[model samples]
Target: MGFFTDCSRALLTILSLTPASNRHFSQHPLALQDITIEPEKASPGFKCQYPSLKGWTNCNGPNSRDCWLKDSASAQPLFSQYDIHTDYESVFPQGIHREYWLNVTDKVISPDGYLKTEGKVVNGSYPGPLIEACWGDDITIHVTNYLKTNGSTIHWHGLRQLHTNEADGVNGVTQCPIAFGDTFDYKFKALQYGHSWYHSHYSLQYPDGVAGPLLIHGPSSANWDEDWTPILISDWSHRSAFQDFYVELGNSTSGVLGREPTMQSIVLNGTGSYTCDPSTDKNCLPQNKRKPIFSKVFQQGKRYLLRLINASTESAFVFTIDNHVLEVISTDLVPIHPFKTESIHIGIGQRYSVIVEAKPSAPVQKDGNYWIRTVVSDGCGTINQSKPEIGVIRYNAGSTALPTSTNHTGLSTLCADEPPENLVPVVPWPVDHQAVNDVLNDTFEAFVSNNVTHGALRWDLTDTPLWLNFSNPTILNLGNTTWNPEYAIIQESYDRGYVYIVITTQAIRKDPSKNTHSVAAHPIHLHGHDFVILAQSNQTYDVSATPKTFNFNNPPRRDVALLPAGNTGGYLAIGFKPDNPGVWLLHCHIAWHASSGLAMQILERQSEILPTIPSLDPTRKTCKGWDKWLAGHVLDQDDSGV
Candidate 1:
């Protein structure tokens, strides 16, 4: 497990990697105020409150105050559904396009126990509006450009985007973003089902709340009765969350490009901790009718499934209902053998569905109050904070006990109990998806060397040239070690004109920069699919044994990794068939780093190669060329310069 306690320092140290590579960015500068979204709702427990959570900060990386950190919002109608038409687009003009807006104000809601978005949705809905359709249903979204920027596209989070390559909505590599104000209609036949999301494929606009959920409810596979819930978790900061780090190192190093944040909080289903509830000052929301209230009633011994979605932009957490254990059944969008555990650690973009059982015979906890516990932590899985968000799993307040009421904990454990003869089918599934069969794969690793002499130097992911050995980064000037135990980002670069996502500080931060002496462990996420952690030199990664195991068949999938500073760096083997074609984004999931410059793009399968140009009519550009040639021969007047 790699640990990065001081994200700012780490980034500063790492910036020594190649400050010159990012020199070009100094030009074509974009202002912080120009960032599209402002602060409103940051995250679950970290509420700044309206009047106090004001300002426009830069989007450096996660954990940085530059986030325009969320101030917290409590509006009843979190998300409202609305019909919208948009065109699928792709943009890759080297900063050639104008700007646009996603207006996080569009809001939408998922059925079951979900926290609503106060604003930031197109119509004010979290996950935006649901695009409802059937397996074979064809849906078209006509995207209307509203920003001054030209290049942009919308990537369907979980959609195949297989045959509809152009509709893949990737910028640059797939298709050019529609011209500012131009409209592109995205048409696709609904294939699979289940919980999914959508977001801009152009810039950091996503963290600004430019993303939304896409749910496709298909035929129920398992004949279970109850409904499902999505536990979406994300890191939010209203102001520049990493600015403090940036201020320290200044020009000497890459400096912490991320914004520094003031406070960090965890939210439950999008709401603040029910821990105290409507009690603490403004922290406790006022008693209102809009608060979402959901209940789960089941027969004793009967089975119910709780589909959990760890949608947090950052943070790897454990979800539990105190008394009840969660059975691991499915992950991401794939099904696994039903395995039960007391608690499950969920990382961003990971999903799990467990069946909860209310023991008909077990005595119910006297009252309806039940603890919904979630633990946020450091990479090694340390319990950074054990937050208990409370909820009720009891009978109606005054209603008399009916003939039979199942256990108070409406959920069930995955072990010991065998799911019924049939289990709930994984929703919106592929015709015949086979992730375990893909054969072709690859892996690599390296170390970083530092320049402690001047408190600076360049580093790389390989021994090739810029790598580093964090444990012994090197000796620098005045005994002022460039390799502090604190700096989270060991290196950062904008080398090829593209932002290469580095540490997702806001995604996970420990103490204040400068004051803290611990290095940072950024949680970086890639867009398309999971990647396998191969190997790490220095302390950059963690490994189990000499020779790591390989999943010739199937490997665990994840979007982020916590980089360490020494020899025993962690390594994981992840593989996903590059069946879906288009430009796929492979960068750090951290919002702040992604914003500052810790991001990059991967050009996947080439677009459909076409034959030589088909003939054009006489009035076409080709014909005009012939006309010009003839005129050049017929005129003189300084060679017909006019």
Candidate 2:
């Protein structure tokens, strides 16, 4: 943790985000103030009907639901209320069972002593409810917004909604927000099977603690005799300028996400110690002691499916359960070949499922006793803020707690003991004079085209000319912005060194001719890859008009570098070797923009046996009316047929 310290404060872009800051929370409509929500036991789902807009319905039960606005309101506005029941289920949430709600008020505290709150919340729980399902299950959820003035839309992060496009709730793109005093249904089948998550899609509620774990269990036919538990980790902070996160991330020895910002504390299975002292969180004390219900236990020689979700609005941590070797199976709703590792790297809004086999016996019989230790570090493999907390994997707790020993420890026998790589590329060095000079006289150009940022990535999605556009054209030529004409402008800002080959400028910089300037630089940090920094100029990077060669060797492998604010474009080359499967986040380091819609997930293709998301029940066809409309839009794809 001490190592995260050397950075130029002036150029440090704020990359750390929390659940409450207005930037991520976005303001929830216009309510006078947040009215407190007092928890009371009530039948789970809403029983009454509310008027529907855009033909939206509330058929979705507590399990799954969609919502829309009610003519957008304002006032001392009497807010509505919803109730939910949570239990100690397994990592996998059963079919049609989840909690969702609009968090009216209350603040979220961070390990670094920051408190954050505001906005609608799913399942009424921070990090939301842990959803578990087997392959091929019909998941239905109905959400009711009790907030006075806000509206929101929730999205199942990483779930493939095959023919379900509207259900692919991405605000302003898929559908509209679930307005105040209204409810909608979110019905979909779990098609692919792997660890996934859910969060508000319409507004900034996503980063505002409105996300949770979604785990899909593998087919029962697989080999293994063990139980699984989901450990969802979040770096929470309300709105403390003192703990503004960016300071911890940038100033730390590691650049941005590359370093372990000082988290208030790492949460295990949603709870830590009872003393409320995160710094001295000792998870070993028995339930009789404090935070008793938070205990995690496992028998030796058994494979425990660990569903790991990085729910942090910012910091990512490397979780390591002492003395246990984890056989990682999947990440972000997809799987890599089964690989063993001492710990797994969990990034913000990412998930990893691994099977950890407990050792039957201690490795060394010291004083006829042994201690099991669990620890974690920065998920990006940079700097760590906290020391590893140790806990014993107690065998036969009540009975003769024989001095633990690894006499027959089966960890090495049950799984490969090799560790998994962090996979995020470590920058070799900052760009020095030699590296910069290498690109002084080289350039190349390619054809450029445009593609719609559709909700469904690989299907019936389209714009017009399907050909790939490679040239860096004026922002307006990209079709990214459909913005109002009054605010748009043009300028020729400059970045001393950098270039951006923007793919969607037509939608952003809407005007091509007037020497327009309303452009923002995206400090896109490459994961597991490094690119060469080229020259930067005003306007944009015109590959067709300028030079185009890249330098990969001896390149700066930094974790974070700005693309220079106001520059229309910049260029660099990311090197990916396909070491890990599953999608990784590529977007503006700015948390607000990133939360809004400025992000893309790139799947690192691999041949390893990967996990699939649980499929939705074939029997359920939404409602009778909604069925025909959806069937008409069902996408068809395949090489042999359509």
Cα deviation at 352, candidate 2, in Å, is: 1.7
The runs of at least 3 residues in candidate 1 whose Cα sits more than 4 Å from the true structure, single-residue gaps closed, are 1-119, 145-153, 170-182, 189-191, 218-223, 229-231, 238-263, 273-285, 289-302, 360-363, 379-386, 390-392, 397-548, 557-567, 596-600, 607-642
Q: TM per model?
A: 0.52, 0.46
- Model 1 gets an lDDT of 0.35
Model 2 per-residue lDDT tens digits across residues 1-642: 001112411111121111111112111232223221111111243112221122222222212211111112412111111101110010111122333333322234332222333423555555566665533344566655444333455667666443343355443333344445455566555544556667665334555555666665432111344544455665443343223423422322321121223334444444442224434543223334433223345565655666676655444455665445767655454434456666654545556667666563235343322333223331222212332342334444443243343322222321111122322112122332332222222221111112222211111101211111111111112232332221111111221333232332222332233222223333343332223333333245554454443343333222233333323443333322222222233444334334322344333332210222122221122222223332444322110000
- Model 2: how far is 500 from its true place, Å? 16
lDDT of each: 0.35, 0.36
Indicate the TM-score of model 2.
Answer: 0.46
